[model samples]
Target: MSEPNEALRRLLRESGWTLSQCARAVNRVGAEDGTPLRYDASGVHHWLGGTIPRGQVPRFIVEAFSRRLSRTVTCAEAGFEPQSGQPSQQTDIVDELIELGRYDMDPSRRGVLGATLFSVTLTVPDWPNVAGRLVAVESGRAHRIGVREVDAVRAMTEELSRLDDQFGGRHARPMAAAFLVNTVGSHLRADASEPVRKSLFSATADLLYLTGFMAVDEGLHGAAQQYYLKALEYAGAAEDHLTYCTTLRGMSLQAVDLGHAKRAERLADAAAAAAPAAGPRMRAFLAGQQAHSYAATGSKHQALTYIREAEVAMEKAEARAKAFGSYAPSSLAYHVSQVKYALGDKVGAIESLKESDRLRHSHYRRSSVRYNSLLAERQFELGHLEEACSTWERVLDDYPLVSSGSADRKIQHMKSLLRPHLRNPTAAHVYQRAQDQAESA
Candidate 1:
């Protein structure tokens, strides 16, 4: 009873139209327009199982159904809720957005969105093709200044990153986005030298990437995907290899989160190839990303291979050089552990995470949030009911908004693991306490 299917059923029920009737209507209209659309009751049934329709088919479906019922159609109305549950098998706005983000990360992956219909899930109203056609925009004409202003823009970008680290990205993302669009964007259009212009674009792209990532963390996925695409364009123009690699990694991460493991792996591989001369830290980051992709695809051997590669790369990275915005060894290890956990190697994941913590003395607030969830997972897997509950309690206290994908998934898994233990009074007490703390927090 997925929303899309339910919505289709409701439309049929209200309109008193058979599934074949709706399908015929869509096909007829599409044929007239030289666009083919095909669907039936079986299709509707599949959509109910969370299948996403693709290309103009979704719009065709909406229009056909709307015409029949004398009402409007929306993705949400059709039960294609974005980010509320498992991704639909049919392509929708979510699929387009994620694909757009991935495409932006690795420009080599770019293609007509329509062609990806069968491969993608769900339909999105605003596709990436629309974004690609948009020209570079300079909304703030008066903000234009000379090369001297470039330094100011770079500084502002760094300051924003600092703020994001201190306060969560959610709190700082809007301000950062505004600065990129208003300030750094203006600099890009200013009368600056080629070098200064390139620098400005890179800075702007980084800011945009940060904003998009923060939005992703906040579950504003479609919006995040759009932002990532824009950031990728800026990075391409700047020819900044590192920023480009990071942007692609961001896209890969989003794809993996959406369960598009194959796409994620392709993106990560492209990122590594793009930055062949990447520093140790950079290589480590890309390798770790590949590891995640492998794990998600259920390729245990590949996951471990990339994880080990990341470790080797990090070892060769200079400590001082790492200060200049490189992902540390510990950070890479943390990523590796995430992959292991995804592959259900709980013991291996826990050991890797513990080792990562030991090496990477500094903890990212964002990472700490993920780590706490992971620790609870490890405890749950080990059958330490009370310990798992206590671990979750600590996580709740540390990061209250633990309802995002990573945290929510961990909680769901742990709950399933603790179901049998719930009958025990002691275990139940701890679990309830943890749940209450999590809910209230």
Candidate 2:
């Protein structure tokens, strides 16, 4: 171990608390936030001996000290910036997101991924401010974006969405990133009429959402998060409340995928609060996401409540003519399936997904197969091992044709699920097939 951390030791001494007490406080704080720190006196002893905590631990420690001292304290003041660099402060996040966008557009650069800490603490600061923050619009530029250009961007986004649905983000991301760099980025700075500017901002937000989604496909989660934040910023600048909340849903989706259910629920709840008057489809979508977040974090009551709310909202949406928009209407069944599975309603989840599979767009074969594989896993969990193995037959059929990181993960996990049942004939056959498919992939 290195020498004692003078900064942290000084803070401990000034606070007049034993190291064990500080550790317990940090653990309590972590538990309230859905992160079980399990810190004890020994952990504090290590921290004083220059051990830098990882993930959200440093943030929790700072919080613990801050609460005890009745003053703000940052990680750096407590000597916790070595493993990862200090996160960009909340006030500087906008500029940081912009900088992140530039890094993303640079093809030669690779943003953070794999073992890099995702500070849930750093993603959204001052949630209310972000919800209403109005970014400054520049007055003049060499190029003026008009209605025609804005319309063109919207049309392009729709076509890109179709392609992303049919193929995958792997096929469409380069173009989306290039569009942001070549067109949307410049348009944001160009002078235009108020209506045109707002439309352009809205279109840019749409483009950024696509860019962020594609980043997830590429497994650049950190960069994807930054893009979503910038998208929300532009959406707010456009005064488009629906788009802003929509971006929040995207962020929440990523959070759930990353296993940060607590943060996911926070973003989802914030979206629900901000979009009280969104159209039925949008409202249904937000409600479904809340159900997903709640389920992931084991909040069964909250999850089930939002699940019914989502179903009701979607029924209301379908009663009217589908509104023209950039988003696909809420797939209530698909979203609900996730919640059902999380809540241990496995049969319910499978039934919901099967229903969703029927109504799903033909263009999204990758997602369909992925959902089927999930259904199979639930079957396996419930002791129908042979049936579960057979269920994957369709997945393997489509697996070769599709290119998706998410799909790949599903297939990989499903393959693991088969290994335990390999003594059975059907399981043996399916395991061999999975092995062969892996080689081909």
Candidate 3:
């Protein structure tokens, strides 16, 4: 009925385990992971008979296989789709966020962290229309929230924002997630009045959005996707249109990074539409995102058009610092690199990246490493192997300090690029050093 579950059948054949045994293993694994699933021989037979299990069963099945094989086994390979469908209520989104953080904390379930693709759902969440009441504050227990409390959250965000620049999300993601779980989680549901609740929502939205960025840096795109969506839902609830638009831009950036360029362009455009009267900083940021997506999609004309528009907006911009980071000259240079690379102007891309390097922010070490890796690759592309190799050395010096999946990718890519040049002593040394780094980590 459902294509005979051939993928699952194949995996089963390779594992050399009976369906019943697999069922027991899966159920056991689920219990260990805190997801109590009740599966047995019949359930396994049904799945093999083309009845795909729903809920978290798919994840459990994959995890079971991962344990048995001593390697990661993704849900897709087990013929399972992601858990989908819009969460019905605002509280549901909050609840989901909390669970996500907990799951992230579990080292056993961390294999699911670097999910390969993003789930696409662009339904403008209808959360705001459903309810107008805030959760009741606990009597004598709910922390009294005022402007001061909100400002404190903002201050914390600003500091972490700088750290995220200097060290990278690998360095900051756990703290952000812990902050969400330990501090922000209770505030979302714990009592407050109209104005206070609104401010709380807005403040939490910024932190959640940053958490999403942290997820991105860790190469957990699916986690980032949920974090962004939940932040957007919070923004809508807060009536913070600017944050809503900014969150949308963050979502667009994630999609582009994941290579869903068409959807990325759509998301970027949606951000602009959400805040048609946004200030120049956001306007330039959105335009730059749009241009990158266009370039990715090979729409050079539209890409260049948006590029000019972004530069014009940047020129008119005032430096307003927020949790999103101040829009410095480096930001524009970063966009220029993307645009030029997309247009097949390798040399121009390299130049833009180098300039951006000078203006780069403190805590964005992951992006710094990533873009520099790009710059090195570009240099290699232009037959400047010595320069490229030198750049690799510089990035390698910092790579071990950050715990970013994105940075992991850049390092791995750098290693691959060195493979062809093993004849060169410098490249050989870097390659051996990468091996040592991998072994030590």
Model 3, span 1-441: residue lDDT tens: 466787788888878889789999888756544457878889998998889787667866876676566566776788877544332233465676677665555566544543323454434453344223333433344565667767777777777776776677775777777777777777666656679778887888888888888877776766777778778767777778777778878888887876668778888888777777878887888888889889999999999999898899999998774746346678789888998998899899999999988888645676678888988989988999889888888788888777777788788888888898999988898789889999998
- Model 3 TM-score relative to the real fold: 0.77
* Candidate achieving higher lDDT, 1 or 2: 2
lDDT of 2 at 100: 53
**Where in model 3 is the C-alpha error above 4 Å?**
1-93, 108-117, 121-143, 323-325, 439-441
lDDT of 2 by residue, 1-441 (tens): 587899999999988989789988898767644467777889999989988776778867887787677667777899877445323444443344444554555555443222222345554533356544546654457877789999999888878766666666666776776677666667767778878877887787787887778777656565677677777877877777876787788888888977779879999998888887877777788889999999999999999999898877777774532122223432678888899889888898888877877777777766766788877887888898877877788778777777776787788888788777678888888778888988876
TM-score of each candidate structure, all chains considered together: 0.65, 0.77, 0.77
Which sections of candidate 2 miss by over 4 Å?
A: 6-48, 51-98, 113-116, 123-134, 137-140, 318-330
Most accurate candidate by lDDT: 3
Error of 1 at 91 (Å): 26
Model 2, C-alpha of 270: deviation from truth (Å): 1.4
TM-score of 1: 0.65
Clashing pairs in 2: none
